[model samples]
Target: LNAAPGWGTRLVAGAVVVTFMASYALFRDWERFGPLLLRHPTLLALDTLFGALLLVSAGPGSTLAYVSVCTPFLAGLIYGWRAAAVFASLQGLVLLLVHATLDNPHTGPAEALLLPGLCVVAGAAGSSLRQLMLRFTEATRALTEMRARLAVTEAVSAERARLAREMHDSVAKTLHGVALAADGLTRSAAAPDIDAARVRQQSGLVARSARRAAAESRELLADLRRESDPGHGTDVLAELAARTRDFHARTGLTATFRPTGGPAVPPVPPAVARQLLTIAAEAMENAHRHAGATRVEVLAGVHGGLLRISVHDDGRGLPPGTDLEQLRRTGHFGLIGMVERAASVGARIRVGRGTRTHGTEVRVDLPLAALTATTREA
Candidate 1:
């Protein structure tokens, strides 16, 4: 079978042919028939025959006879070493016939055989070069596959780490608080001179804590299941509004959602959408459980190529000099987790005093370009 040679083989063949033609023109006078023999179609169709004829015309002792080496070299590159050897043998037989006819004084049998020997050497070198290129291409393909596999492993590891952090920040913390309240209630009940009012209050606190823990567990499980379900065709802003209403119903807090700047927010990938939802949930949770805010407003808008989402509560703002790093050091992982979630999706997060100066605002800003690119990839 005839295989197409690589560009490198073609380039070498071109250079050799150019040099051979130049040498032939310099060493010998060109006849009118030379033009016809050098035509593109004739050269392609009778490449080996042309080389054999030129060698016979030049004779064994001439400098131009060595240029015939290109015929076998090109054959090896295109059709392997066996085809090259056959071409070289044919040229050698033509040279033997020419030498026997001419019987030139300067050219012996050994001198005639030398030209074919050189052609054989050139052919073997071309075959070795083609083999080297094949090996290199195979190696490059293997390396690319290995890198793709490594990237997938890294992505899986990062996802697992994110899930572990989510569990620690939400359900685990809620259950720990419930356990502490239950223990306190048990000790109060064991007291011989129990104050009924204090015991009843402790019982109520334990029940509420247990219920909150159960709710937190359910929400976490729901988030985990949603990761695999790709049918989330609902707009993220609408979902955020629903979450605010649910928060108000469950906790009796006055939580509201308002859209500003534009009527719609551009769509984002599921991974980015999930992170944004979790960040908003954490912000509202912190306002309800820690800030003790009676009124909470969730604002979402697109402004100057940025998708901004902010949760503002008319509660006690963050303590003086408190930042994400300080919160992490003090074991308050809720806000830290929110920041991590924002960072995971290439968004920026901030927590500070609200516009009222007496409340807290947790805000996340994501680039519109990021949303568009993620949507296209999804």
Candidate 2:
């Protein structure tokens, strides 16, 4: 397309050359020479064609020098590097041929021959310059793409950090309170001269709080599990048994847990494990505190593709018309926490006045889907 300007310049130069020839013919012997060449048709044709070629080649001004330089640049713009080089060489050949038969004593044949070489050099330079520009443009585009990806990655990282902070503030605080309450109750139970009932109540409170703390602690850790290794070690059934043993050791409450079925580790998601443990702890605590119970039993197994966890205590049953809501509200963290955790994991948790052994019973039945096998393996 840049060749467009050079072509226009050549056309204007041709028109001016035509005007000059017209004026020169009027004042000189151009007519006499024109008739002499006509007697020889071949010579007349050659002379006329050479005059037209000269006019067309002489671009916008009398300076044919400027035209020689511009032709190659124009060729380079229109035909890239290789074609531009060929055009430059062709222009020199045309100029040499035109100068050969022309009688006008303007420039020498050697000068006409040098014009094409100059065009090739200029065209090559233009090609090199264009290549450099393209390379720089490509580099810029690549940098822009990299920067956009970097921004997206940073945004995701920041969002994860914010979520971690929120988890700490909400779940972490609640768990801490429960743990402190357990420690307080445990210390209270160690006092001397306390009645049996009072001692039992205090011990029960401690066990309940401890269990809630453990559950919450597990939950807090679950969110931090690796994406590639999304599993928590230790089976849920084994965890229940371990907690029961720990409770007995700590409070001398005689807590016992058994899995009724084959040694299949029932799938248990982290949320389900937390809730079931909390519920068991709450059930046993209520029996010991309010019912003066001596034995607590925890039964855990899988039934019909569901995880069943039930806690039964041989303590006195809950009082008639007991305000279960009020009981849950008055720092009975176990009941409320258990329910919340169960709901989170889509488990069906029930706490009622009586079950086997005529004591308070709490049971949680969770769907197999809610209890992930990956979590159990973890």
Local accuracy by lDDT, each model: 0.71, 0.60
lDDT of 1 by residue, 1-378 (tens): 011368645654564477567647733764654454434433523666765555555555555466667667755665667766776676666667767767468776687778778878888876777678778988885564344334333333465467779889877887788788878888888989888998888788878877887887787666555544434322778879999999999999999999876636875545567778889988999899999799999999897767899999998888898877888788999988887777666677888984666899998887666655433333
In Å, residue 369's CA in model 1 sits off its true spot by 0.7
What candidate 2 gets wrong by more than 4 Å, as runs, is 1-163, 166-223, 226-228, 231-234, 328-333, 353-357, 373-378
- Give per-residue CA lDDT, model 2, range 1-378, as digits (tens): 112467776776666577557647833985776555335444423433453455445531235434555545544543468755765665655555555645557766566666656767777876776677788988985564344334323333443465478568765675676677667566666667546776567567657766765676575465445311335433678888888888788778888898975547544443335456777777766767777878888888878656788888777766676565876767666567777666555566787644464776788876554334334233
Worst 10-residue stretch by lDDT in candidate 2? 148-157
Off by over 4 Å in 1: 1-234
Q: How far off is residue 217 in model 2, in Å?
A: 13
User: Pairs clashing in candidate 2?
Assistant: 232-378, 233-378
What's the true lDDT of residue 267 in model 1? 59
For residue 224, model 1's alpha carbon misses the true position, in angstroms, by 12
**How many steric clashes between backbone atoms does each model show?**
0, 2
